[model samples]
Target: MQKYLSLLVLACLLAFNASAQQLRLITGTVKDSLRNAGIPNVVVRVKGTDFLTATDAKGNFKLKVPAGAVTVEAIATHFKQKEIMVGASQTTVHITLNLLQPLITDSEKNRYIMDDKKGLSEVVVTGYAAPRIASGIHIKASPQNNTEDYSPINENIFHTATDQPLSTFSIDVDRASYSNVRRFLNNGQMPPADAVRVEEMINYFDYQYKAPTGKDPVAIYTDMAVCPWNTGHQLVRIALKSKQVDTKDLPPSNLVFLIDVSGSMDEENKLPLVKRAFKVLIEQLRPQDKVAIVVYAGAAGVVLPSTGGSEKSKILAAVDELQAGGSTAGGEGIQLAYRIAAEHITKNSNNRVILATDGDFNVGPSSDGELERIITKERQKGIYLSVLGFGMGNYKDNKLEILADKGNGNYAYIDNFEEARRTFVTEFGGTLFTVAKDVKLQVEFNPQFVQSYRLVGYENRLLQNEDFNNDKKDAGDMGVGHTVTALYEIIPTGKNSPVVNWVDPLKYQQAKIMGNQAEVLTVKLRYKEPQEDKSQLLQKVLPYSRQQIEQVPEDFRMTVAVAAFGQLLRNSAFKGTATYEQVLAWAGKARGEDPEGYRAEFIQLVKKAKLLDKE
Candidate 1:
């Protein structure tokens, strides 16, 4: 018996030693080939196993995997996924990923063919194939049942500064338009004119403006230079940056993920992508934070009750088990989510309902007006709404924008996994945490120095002149670390401008130049604290400058490129000489320190646009 026990012990020891020898620590770095910079938040996984880790801020990662020949995978947002094989003796590895090139999928080609409503018949070109034309450009058309909706935008016309000196609008922080347009471009089609919101595209890239130095939570910066599109006109760039909150200082959150699992969401990019996006947000939650999963299809139901963030396993399981089917009852789902949020509302906590959907509400008060009324009423209860639009064919951009606007919230369209990472991981605070509510801007131009001016973009966000000061009127909200950018093209006094029409001199009242000659404009802003009912006022005076466009900051030039790109896409009457080639040139030069490669991606989009325009 003793000899037999000794033999068993010897066998067990040999097995344990072999197991230990099979494990090895692997260290590696992930890099972007285009920018030659390390990429943060990249997922490194040992293929065919559950061992996974993420790169740190510097793109460094370490993980233990079985020794001997093994396969590894690296994945990141906006970049192509890559795989590498490691030899038995290797302990260190390096991986480089290329940026994803836009490709026209079969579904994208079919969307164009199905859209007979866009005045496209069954006409075929001699050189083009059934689905793809040369250079991968597909003939632009909407699907017959596309059901996609965009609000019509009448381009803002040049205003006579002497006749209308004040331009008032709400500060919009939503950047859905940029991503939506990107989706269209990536699909090898041009987006409808109404889908290109110029201000949103300009605000999409972070300008890294200086944060607030005063007690206020927001800071304003102004710059003026010769307009690139129209050399005769000067462009005024007004930027507002909100104070950044440290991760440790972020308030505990009470979040309800209102996910749409309707039949329309059955596509891989719809409900599945939403689940993946929510997982990213889940990774950011703290022990004090709580999240609930509320899903809607035929009806709304809670798959998981309010659970502490520490129970991530439980939450993830609930999310993974969700399936998509049935008609969308978005209104019911919203009501349930808000009720759940209100029940667990914690004082001083960030309470919000994140609605992830394609904005297809087929049943129960789905009209834009009805939905807006619902969101507006719920917003008064201290529960904010953030809309995350997913999918494409039947995307209801118009309805989603209205829900966000009325709910005092922000909206984003997640077209791919990279965008999902950007929204939920890279921009966690700005997408979810509100810093200032009811933010409004009023620019009063000096007629002495300006002949005519036009506020670019922000057609829907325009507010009445008196609405700027009315505390009761609700406006847009700014999130933590959010930056709002606005542009105004001004024709300097005595300059020949094609957009401006001469009018007879005022007969009854003579115009007088009362303000300082150097004062080009006075910008008045109003904002309310997230929990406050009353608003606070802030103002700044802009001094005139003759700075040329070439002398301005790289960020300013980058914004000009984006704005011009937007105008060209929209075919604006006031686009002047803006061309896709010019946009590419300006953007290429201004792609500074593009660690995340967003600006670089913008340049690629311009290249695609230039090619598609030729088609």
Candidate 2:
């Protein structure tokens, strides 16, 4: 009886101790400068413990802490970190952190921070975020050179012809505001937003490219129609198709893959997705192809030396062994991969380096100048590079684009498995094979036929007018089956639209008369042979009526809607008459004949976004 009583007493003591060791529940919402607006995916860490939590879709986080005073830290990309001390009895806490200005201000005494009051004056609402003003960075367009072949088919389509060029050009419009709004919506428990990249959104749909019915080098087609918003403008879509090249037809390929296995890439969307994407590419490789894999994180090393494509199991096994950790040494990895590719250089065959990363190069040679120098030097060795960007949140789009541009390669952003398949499998030739390097488009608007114009997208790809004909200046590359599209929004001379008021009148400049009104725009494309430095030009004229081309097919309209949606997400000034509902309608109408069900999936995404907005 005494033993039983003792056992009961011990049990009671254990229960009391367990209950007294209190666990406090804390809850809070993270916000930006204005307050109350939640920030999503903010990383929260407890100072002394390994415990961490990310804000939910609603920007809310809940954590349990031991019964003692502790410090909580919250960090996010582009935003300042917030830290707070919690007392032993404090069960809940709230915090707000403001986004840091990307630009630095020069003060008389020292470089310091400036409020965004003046910056906010430049905001133009285009449906995504609030307006953002220009960053005071001046982007000069190439001067009008009289060289006939070097001139753009139409200046209005490719250049700003108006005095208020900033107002007309979407590239100069505010993007930070749009991005901020998007972050808010995405964190506010809103459904996955349909913020497809303008370029990718348009490129996702397969336009009708004349397939080689008979023997031909390649087949190409283009569709030009009036932009829905502005009847005075047109959108040009180009499609190129190459004859299927089987494994036997493919030349021996020496391939080097440069991968980032940094700690930031620990998420499933980063390293795991990269492995899966590469696996697809491996399956499509020919037996003659040789592949080498290089990884960078704190240090760079060759994980897998040159191996035959036929040895699929061996390559995949090496891939499976990869795990993400450590800081990114992207420069070291690039150098090592280039060395391997140069060592295995094959004459008259495919030699390339493929870079896969989230573009966070924090550990070594992370500066833009250093990275560009490395890539530029490597490109001179007659080896091409391709950049595949993965993951988000901490993504570096600017850096990735620069690398591909200077490396004589192409750039792609993979948001999911479907994009992976599309880039690696469906469009392998364009993604892997290069046809032309340093492709530049320059347009010369005939002052006689046009008034104001703006080029859409390609904000970072602009070049000097002299650079167009320099041949030495590098530009974008074109793959075997790749298609590049550019859009323009125009305001005709006669239109009385009051989009922007000119600060000063150019009364001294005489308005030119229109000799021929038939031609609305002209396009000039210059490209160089992959191995050559000189470029060849292709020119085409689009008529004015084509600018008003209507009754576009549902598929084509859907494609435009996708691009428009992207512009809206970017808060582009050119996004006139493009609404979320309109985008949804177009997507729904074109969700037919989806053999892979990708279109259906996009439709569902749109619906989800709509439902979230209702909520």
Candidate 3:
């Protein structure tokens, strides 16, 4: 017995030693060869394994890998992926990646580049060279082939205050448009006019608005400044800041990852990016939280049953196993995911179905109206839906927007891994946890202080004035740590404007001026608690304290700059004197306390847009 025990211990020790010997600590830095600058957010992965880590802001990464002949791969946007083989003795590596040059196409026509390594067909501007198609690769042809969808937006026209006193809209917290527009500008293409939602663009950055000190979940703030675009007009900025919740204080989450593994998702930025993004979210989960994964291709089915977040390896494995193939059955997948969420529903828990897709629903109940109806019915079960749109070319923004709006959730477009980090890490609480639902805003302009007003953006979120008081009416949801902003360009009561043409005195009943003379406008907000059916009302009056554009707060100025940029992108008729140069100047001055560098990146994007506009 003693001899047997000694042998067992020896055997275990030898096995442990062998395992340790097989592991190697690898460190590396990835840099742009042309610019000699470190590349950040580059994915460095070990081939044939799920071992991957992104480079930090300085392009440095460290990971453990199995010893022996190992293949290391580095991938980043706008850079050609590269792979290197390391021997068992190798402990450090330096990788250099080449930037992809824009294709010079003839007649300004669309050009394609085949990324064989990622099995992706990337679209680029104006190229004459023949596309190099990989052998043995079959690209599927479907009804929704290579065409992106966006809902048309007719820019808001000036409304006379006496003729139309109330301007109502749902508060949009979704920042998908900014990232989507970034994607277009990054790819050297001008985005469609409808894709530029100015309200969303303005709401993308964090603003240091005052936190709620009352019982309400959101605090309201108003700022009045000389309009940067139209000097004769004033820009009224309405800001709402939701209460912040720490990660440790958040409720236990019951999450269902509804992933679209359709053929259209085969691109590197689609299925692979989805898997990587979910991994980021999975790391944020606690033992008390649970996650279930449901993938849809030709049919909808569960890849992993509801499992505790402690079993992260298992959930990650399920996500990694998902592959893109067959047709999309998005509607069926939605039903299955919501059913799982409902079954596991608990009181005071954060229950949500996160749908990751390119928004291509071809096989089952694919129309926007049909999917909207299905989501509308499912949302009543207390299960919210969050749509993370992936990929381009065939992206269906219109459908995704509708699903999120009607399903009482938020929509975001994940154009790259950095965006994935922002969505899942920096804004984790705001992305997955909802604090208030059906949040609507109704602004009553004081005819005494304002002549005509126009909502700067949010064309799609505009609601009838009656809908503000309707408890059953669906609207946008406000998440923890969310900052929502809306800008209204107003021509002061006596200012004559080219845009605002007064009708020869109202033939019908004219609105009586009754508000305080010192007030610019009265803003009313309605919202419901996450688990409540009834809505609560909050109101605030914007005092007529107009400040010069230079004297307003930095946040107010930054938001105005963003709105102007959006209008420039859309080429709106009301974009009075709003040049890209003006946007750059205002944004440069107001780009304050950008810890995340989002504002700096916005400035860079504006520079790019200026060049593109000239082209």
My TM-score estimates for the predictions, one after another, are 0.77, 0.66, 0.76
- Cα lDDT tens digits, model 2, 243-355, are 45554665678899899999988998899999999999989888889999999999999999999999999999989899999999998899899999999887767889999
**After superposition, candidate 1 runs with Cα above 4 Å error:** 1-141, 495-511
lDDT of 3 by residue, 492-511 (tens): 87522322332334787564
lDDT of 1 by residue, 1-615 (tens): 999999999998997677667678788898867436666656677764434566765678877777778899886533467899998889999998864342222453443232122232221111123221111122222454456766655456567777678999999999999999999888777776668899999999988899998889899999899998878789999999999998779888999999999999999889899989999889989999999989999999999999999999999999999999999999999999989999889889899999999998998878777788778888998889999999988888888998888888789999999999999888899988899999999999898788778899998889999998899999999988999999998888852232133233357545567868899999999999999999999998999898877799999999999999998887564577788888988998899999999999999899888877642
Q: What is the C-alpha lDDT of each candidate?
A: 0.81, 0.61, 0.81
Please give the range of 10 consecutive residues that has the lowest summed lDDT in model 1.
Answer: 125-134
TM-score of 1: 0.77
* Candidate 3 wrongly placed segments (more than 4 Å): 1-145, 495-499, 502-504, 507-512
True-structure lDDT of candidate 2: 0.61
* Colliding residue pairs in candidate 2: 123-131, 142-465, 152-442, 152-443, 153-522, 153-523, 154-522, 155-444, 155-445
Clash number for model 3? 5
